[model samples]
Target chain A: MPLAATLSSVPVVIDEEKCIAHKGCTVCVDVCPLDVLAIDMLKGKAFMKYDECWYCMPCETDCPTDAVRVSIPYLLR
Target chain B: MKTVEWSVDILVVGGGTAGPMAAVKAKERNPQLKVMLLEKANVKRSGAISMGMDGLNNAVVPGFATPEQYVKEITTANDGVVNQATVYAYAQHSYRTIQELDRWGVKFEKDETGDYAMRKVHHIGTYVLPMPEGHHMKKVLYRQLKQKRVEVTNRVIATRVLLDENGAAAGVMGFDCRSGDFIVIRAKAVILCCGAAGRLGLPTSGYLFGTYENPTNAGDGYAMAYHAGAELENLECYQINPLIKDYNGPSCAYVTGPFGGYTANNKGERFIECDYWSGQMMMEFYNELQSGNGPVFLKMNHLAEETIATIENILHTNERPSRGRFHEGRGTDYREKMVEMHISEIGFCSGHSASGVWVNEKGETSVKGLYAAGDMAAVPHNYMLGAFTYGWFCGENAADYIAETYPAGAKPVIDQTQIDLERARVEAPLLRTDGLPPAQVEYKLRRLVNDYLQPPKVTRKMEIGLERIQQVRADMEHMVAGNPHELMRAMEVYHIADCAEMAARASLFRKESRWGLYHYRVDYPQRNDAEWFVHCHVRKGADGEMEHLKRAVEPYIVELDDTEKSAYDRLRVKREPAIA
Candidate 1:
């Protein structure tokens, strides 16, 4: 069986301009209970690595630059 | 991956509401003891109250309600199958826990006179205490743990409790979710506070993680207890709540009910006189949804502008804060349209309903040296406060048990064979590349759970559910994980499978319908107190099969009158009163 990449509108979005992950801040990634967010090593910004989210909002609330926005997951919305 | 070994005086698994309290209290009892708080996620934000709570659902504050009254209320609420001693113990210590949290900077809604502004939500007592600014609850607990110097280890998912030759809890074994490194922790005792089996049933949204309880709580502790020879009580009495339809958060009757918002039908008429969460209340809600006036809702459209704003301010800030955003996305405003509500999927949770690892008044499970608290422990309607109080009990009692049973510098002598077996089981998913995805396996298992095990349960369907669950157990061997995170989910699939089997088998064993809608059986449609009134406990039998037992309900300390015994049965409004 072959597995292919699936597309999803990720709930946690990081504004690259405001995200300070390039400055070595991992607050959002560390605080997410689901461990969904990760620091993009190439882009030097935070991104939702996995589509699995509880919409519980620790990532959005703890972001220092106010760059993280957690929208309700599309399936739920 | 290399194996990591840790030895401590006491190991408290899960840093949720109860686990933190258990660790902190154990340390307070003896500051020299090395107490470790192991968590599946970061301790700062974990467990059921990960996002903080809105109110204490069962706060038995003095002057408002006594321990005796609270015991009687829970007894009647759980349909008289409660161990009154456990509920009474919580009641006696409720105020002390409140004061401790208060001293630690937690806020509560109080009147101008500095009295706890208690609200009447239950059928018989005033227990609801609102926490308007409760979003910082975890921060407060984290600060306490830090101050106490409790050892904290995050991202380690403990799968099984290690047992000694005498069947006593020696420690625990699992692998770290992020690194895939096997972990072995040896201790004199182990406390299991892993929250509800929230992932047992997939949400109606078809989203796997959108469960009412925090998605991380995959019934890990319940499975751990059973595998360690601990007995689980009331496995058939499932937790079914009235939640916001697709979002699966509480429409929060406790918060809105006090402000005059209520559960209403399609015509916007009150059907249930009380909005408190009880099996009987859910039964009425289910009946209303099934009737011509289908799609029950949280009706707040009739409330005054000021009241709605106040309610929104609190509801949007605590507990499931994203609830407001979900409503906004759907264009459903409290002042404009009613919030749609539906009955939640079934799972085992003693916090809301009575289905969990059985524990006595001291928070000790049948297995020696193993303690359980919080949502997973079998204490009915315990809610958040009960978790804290029971955590205090488990922490203090386990500390005493360690002092009495094990000498200082007593180290656990664990069997290497047991550790090797669990490691192979945990690592098998990652070793296979061509195998089923954990999510797909979980989705199918939970779908089957809904189809055959969701209640008004039929005997034949449940038996079929048992067979299907066993099939999933077989498929579990082939469930593959691409990474450690997926491995964590794969392990959770195993836990959910165990719970699904427990739910089906226990539901079949009861032989009678009880707890209103919770354990309603289609075949055994009547409540038979003559033969089925005892607590139904399930555990791993000596033959390695799931075994069922009928433990007689502990004799009641506070007896109830005939009228009080049937209080929850009368939740439906006598007349359909509609707002003009």
Candidate 2:
């Protein structure tokens, strides 16, 4: 059952300049229903770790620093 | 490895439409009780109405329709295998629930005279109530929750309902996605309002997340209820909606149908008399698409500009708002083009059709301290309005049960052995850094569901589906989760696999075709009301095998004459002869 890392353009993106995750804000990651976004321990920024995105907008709407933007997945668009 | 525990009078799992109302009503019922509303996501927006609903699909406004009428309609729409008692309870309280939401700052479409503006979408009665500004519904509910002082826990995914020695619900178990801490909450009464088993089927688009449901509802509630020894009814009557082709969201016939938009075939002719979403209507939709007509569309081009604009405004702003962008990308405009429609991959939803955790009129599941409502609860056509009403029922009822079953120096017992095993199961994926990816396992599982259990179900295919699902169950042991985010998905794969197995089992248990396309077994091609009219229920047995039972359809309180009984079967309007 060996698995390989699959890479693709994630639908949710965070603007690091606006992202305040370094300041202990995990709003986007916390509010996302699918839990696709996670805090990057190295950079202390939130990033989409899973490609499965419902595009339900809770992540974008609840982001306090206005750091998140949701794009329709490239495959569907 | 860290463990957190909570003890409360009532624990409401899920913060979606029903869970919010349940929390609010429970608090309002008995202010002394400790009510905790647990959510996998934030309560501000979650579950089926994360973006809020476009309209109340089943509103029984007093002047527009009576409780009896709404009950009868649901009885027929579900193809007759409904517990009228459960639907009747919702009907009796439908308008009151609407008024309560209205007082809480939720809006519904109103006529010029200030009365509720109701529209007819069903075959016989008027029920649909549009809320063009319904996007703020969750905000309204969240405010109520805050005002009522319901403890809200966000980001905790509940995996199981802990059973007492007597088999009643005692507590629940799961972990927090943020810190990977094990969570075990104990309660006197537990209400499960987790929405549909929506992620059971892979969308035809081949994209994992483009599901008709919010996708967060991976049927965790259904699996938990079954494991708790609660009966789940009518699993074979799968929810196969007519949705936007590539986007996999609803084409929203309910929103546009009242505005003169109808489901049309390739020639752009109306096929069904009613725009309501019943299995029979969906059967016609499936047929037309497969016929020479090939593809179907939501026809609105014939409508006036004003009507189309109103429809677009409501459709683009509420429910699945990304739909507008999907339409834009496809170059689809309601003013000139018909929106393409397709049969969605199947799943179980009591909200849309009759397949969910079985509950009586009081919203109580067979498990004594356990109650269920909303899409997960087995009440036919229990849409957003029904969810709210049933939530109210469950809240007050669970509150009463809590007071009655109050423990004096008694505590909810936990099986430490079970807890250790669950912790091991949740942590295994994280332990193995390079095993089968959660997404791949989920994709393969749902694809297998689509391949083996999609409607027009054949016995051999379903049996094969059961075998493949067992393999998925075994493959789950080798699943990999790089972080808590992926762990959430890995756990969701378990729920989806359980749904796949139970779906196949339920489809096979019923020996005759019913609900049109929902249970149209190829081998058993005709509807056999005599032998298969009873509701098929499944639960985990004492032997740890899936057990099936037959529950008789409660005698209808609202008697339908023979013509009314078959009203849904006549959805196709008669076409007149053409003159030479």
Per-model C-alpha RMSD: 1.6, 1.7
Highest TM-score model number: 1
Q: What is every candidate's C-alpha DockQ against the true complex, given to 2 decimals?
A: 0.82, 0.62
Off by over 4 Å in 2: A15-26, A39-46, A62-67, B407-409, B577-580
Tens digit of per-residue lDDT, candidate 2, span B1-580 = 6888888888999999999999999999999989999999888778899888889889988888999998889888877888888888889899899999999999998989999999898899999898999989889998999999999999899999887777788878998987888898988889999999999998888888888898989999999999888999999999989988878888888888877788899999988898788889888888889999869999999999998888888888888887887888788888889988898889889899888999999999999899999999999989899899999999999998877786565655666777677778777888896678888889999999999999889999999889988988888888888777678889999999889989999999999988889888999999998887898999999999999999887888999988888999988768898998
Q: Model 1 scores what on Cα lDDT?
A: 0.92
Best by lDDT: 1
Question: Candidate 1's error at B298, in angstroms?
Answer: 0.7
What does candidate 1's lDDT look like per residue over B1-580, in tens digits? 6799988889999999999999999999999889999998999888888789999999989899999999999899889999999999999999999999999999999999999999998888999999999999999999999999999999899999999878899999998988989999998999999999999887899988889889899999999999999999998999999999999999989998989998999999999988888888889999999999989999999999999999999999998999889998999999999999998889889999999999999999999999999999999989999999999999999899999988866665677899999989999999999889988899999999999999889999988888988998899999889999999999999999999999999999999989989999999889999998899989999899999999898889999999999999989888646689
lDDT of each: 0.92, 0.88
